[model samples]
Target: MTTLRIGNASGFFGDRFSAFAEMVEAGVDVITGDYLAELTMLILARQKAKDPERGYASTFLSQLTEQLHTIAGSQARVVVNAGGMNPAGLAEAIRTAAHEAGLEIPVAHIDGDDLTDRANTLGLGTPLAANAYLGGFGITEALRAGARIVVTGRVTDAALVTGPAAWFHNWAREDYDQLAAAMAAGHVIECGMQATGGNFSFFTEIPDLRRPGFPIAEIEADGSCVITKPAGTSGAVTAETVVSQLLYEVSGARYAGPDATVRLDTITVTDLGDDRVRLDGVRGEAPPPELKVSITEIGGFRQEITAYLTGLDAEAKADLVQAQFAHALELSGLPRPHNMEWTLARTDRADANVQEEASARLSLVARDRDPKTVGRQFANLLVEFALGTVPGFFVAAPPGEASVYGRFRPGKVSQSEPIHRTHHDDETSLTIPAPTEFRGLEPTSLDAHSPAPANGRTSAPAGSQTPAPAHRSGTTDVTLPLGRLFGGRSGDKGGTANIGLWARTEAAWQWLRSELTHDALRRLLPEFADAALDRVELPNLRAVNFVVHGALGEGVAYGARFDPQAKGVAEWLRSRSITVDADIAGSVNLDDFFTAEHTPASASSGSDAAAGES
Candidate 1:
């Protein structure tokens, strides 16, 4: 079977600077770069407001300029969502750059995803930036039109891979299964080193993680692909690493996209040794009738102040600061903030060796519609009480003026609403139509027990003993951290966060399914006591994913929590102690798994570490 090698260079706007040159040198058929995220759109919007010609990722332009001659000399093609809020502008810029570099690379751009002008009419409220999620066919059309480089705005990240695969295979519009399989491959490599070993929960198991290489998908005509990295790369690509990326930021079995809905439950992962993992048996369904729109708006102004309380009377010191701050606000004669939240983290220890170890953190976050409420006046008020209240009352840093915060919300419109179009170098526009056949997405059902009932009760109100699982009746239980036998991956989806936990063996999976119930999770993580929760089981992957709604309030841009994106929430859950069967725990050999190592052939001895952020 003929295979198209698709490699990812840049995952986000600030990814490794040299990845594009590296991937091109690796001789891949295509290079895809994903630079836009939910928060990125908002940041670009602010940039565009300041300067009209600057909403796109500028780093891509520089990379292309530096490597234009090499790319023009190779058979490799470039596809990137770095166009961000302005595909047409970015395409024109690329053409200008190519001309200046003495290269004639054909650049094409896909647009019509921007919905800011028609937002209110389409029931999407007034937002700073609004872009609909487009399918991959526009990219396919551009590629078929003989464009060597394709620029897109706000398409599904997977479209970079699916579009190229469809174009290469001449797939029809209704080739749902093939498109879904390609989408799975795209999702794996969309974050570059993530599909490799960059953020694997079992990081200790992989060797030479420093400066891991980006991932590539050897996609075949039938939609099956081997997820692997370039030979002599630093990172390891195994079944476990691929599974970790598959579960990251996903909710249920039905992973819906603009082109097709993927049945994540049907997918099977096979390790083919030497850093190659085969993904097959994927099933897909018809595309949804409506397209998802990401809308970001300026919610309000926010300011924060953190005070370090050391030694004794930590509680009293926190109380004194809160009371003083409230009284100061009242006396300032300024309007009160719309919302105020205070958190006291007791990180101090008794008889600590260092002063830093004996201090707790008391933070105050204030938000308001009017900037003056949380602006310089608020900071000055907090500083006024530095000498009057609490012993050793000092802030971590000087509070700055309030800054604008953004809120993200999902909107939907008819798939045909946006005039999807491809602009070629010859000044011709090709319109791409929406899918003729559509289906409403339905919740995926599983044979296992249903998720905990939605009673809005965080924990069994104060006295009722939560019943234990029936499977644990006759087994000897030992208290241990969940990370001892399981691995987890987590990320934020708008305002919600998802944590996917998987076991290494079948027996461990059986124990996990029975022990980690909805109530059990709430009991373990009391911080999510009031948030709405939903749990789904994927028996094929031996994993259970939990979705916590409202965990990040409005979104990552809103700065609702300390760890706003919830990237480390899974690690926090893994640290929580839980009771497990001794047999299941003793059967696993974590030491052996961590000790086994295979050194990379051409590993670079550099200090630059790659982060796995989506």
Candidate 2:
């Protein structure tokens, strides 16, 4: 069977710049980059509004410039979604960069994904930018037609991998199984270091995490691939790592794409040793008729403030600060905000060496439609409480003005709408064919079983549970942070967020699935106690994923919460102490898991690391 080696260089817009050169030097048949995230579309739309000729990722040009000789000298082909809202603009930039490097690389671009014209008619608020997700065949066609570089806008990230794989294998559109397997492979590698131990809940197990190597997929003709990183790199590619990325940002069992729908529940992963994990058994079905449409509009204005409280009565200090800020807002004659976020982060240490060690943080965020109301009202209120706050109180930094950005919305458009166009160059163009068979198909709905009906609890399959320890008759129990026994990863899906938690041992898995019910999750994090949550089990991976509906109020970008994207939701849950069998707890190190850096719900200096916010 023929094997194709594919490497991922860039995960998102601001990923490590050195990854491209590193992947090129590693010598792969195909190199792919994923830069267009849901939030990135809004950013690119604003950029395009400012310059007619620029909307794509300019960093791509720099990557080409730095590794031109390595790329041109090798036989590897490049496919990337750095085009953002403008593939033509990005393609042109790549050509210019190539010329500057004394080389003329033929670059082809895929378009027609932009749905701004049709979006105007939807009347779903003002459309800042609208794009339908494209598939991989267009890229395959471009590569088959001898285009060394293929740039695209708003295509599903997996297309970057599947397109080249389909071309290399000469597979037809109906090769759904192979395509689905390729899609799984692409999903695993699309996020670069994510599949190679970055953002992993069990990150402590991976060595040298400070500088983990990017991922590469060694895909075989049988649709099975071994995920591994470059030699001598920092990270491990174990089954746990692959499973973490597999469940990230995903909802339900079926993961929808333009070309084929992947049955994530049917997928399997196995450790192949030597820093490689094999992925296979991915089933496929016809895709949904509609392409996911992302539209961003003028959401509103948002402002936030961080205050530090030190010494003995940390909680009391936070309480006083929160009350004073609210009173200040009312006294300043500002209208009540549409949504207000007041989060208290406790970071108090028992034996403190510094003032920060014995302090907590109170974060205040306000959002409103009126930009002036949010911006000026917040600025004036913060100054009022500067003198009235508790003793030893301090602002993290000088307050900044509110920011006005686009709000994200997810919708769908008919696949047959002829909304996409592909450009091989200025002279050649082709229309991307929409799926003919599966039009207007509704996706399979996820199912949940409640174990404790009175508490609105969900039950996992009995077969999914691991058997109790055979040698012991009775179980001893201990209380410890959930991170000691389980690893988790979380991400946002517009207004929804998913957190996938897994156990390192069978004993732990049984304890986790039984004890961590939806109600239990609510008890751990009261902020979303009333919010609807759905849980499902992946027994093979010993993992459970919880979907929180309406977690991100209007949308991720417009959400009022400090952690709008819900990236830190799982970590926060893991930090909570849980009662587990003493046998399972004995295997984990409690001290390392409970560090000052991992202090429960603690505020940071100005920066919101949890939200990835400035």
Q: Which numbered prediction scores highest in TM-score against the true structure?
A: 1
Report the Cα lDDT for residue 444, model 2. Answer: 33
lDDT of 1 by residue, 205-309 (tens): 787899899999999898999999988889889877888899888887678888898877777677777888888777788888999999999999999989999
TM-score of each: 0.93, 0.87
**Which residue pairs clash in candidate 2?**
112-420, 112-421, 476-582
Pairs that collide, model 1: none
Per-model CA lDDT versus the true structure = 0.85, 0.77
Model 2 residue 185 lDDT?
Answer: 94
Return model 1's CA RMSD, one decimal: 6.6
Give the range of the ten consecutive residues with the poorest summed lDDT in model 2: 602-611
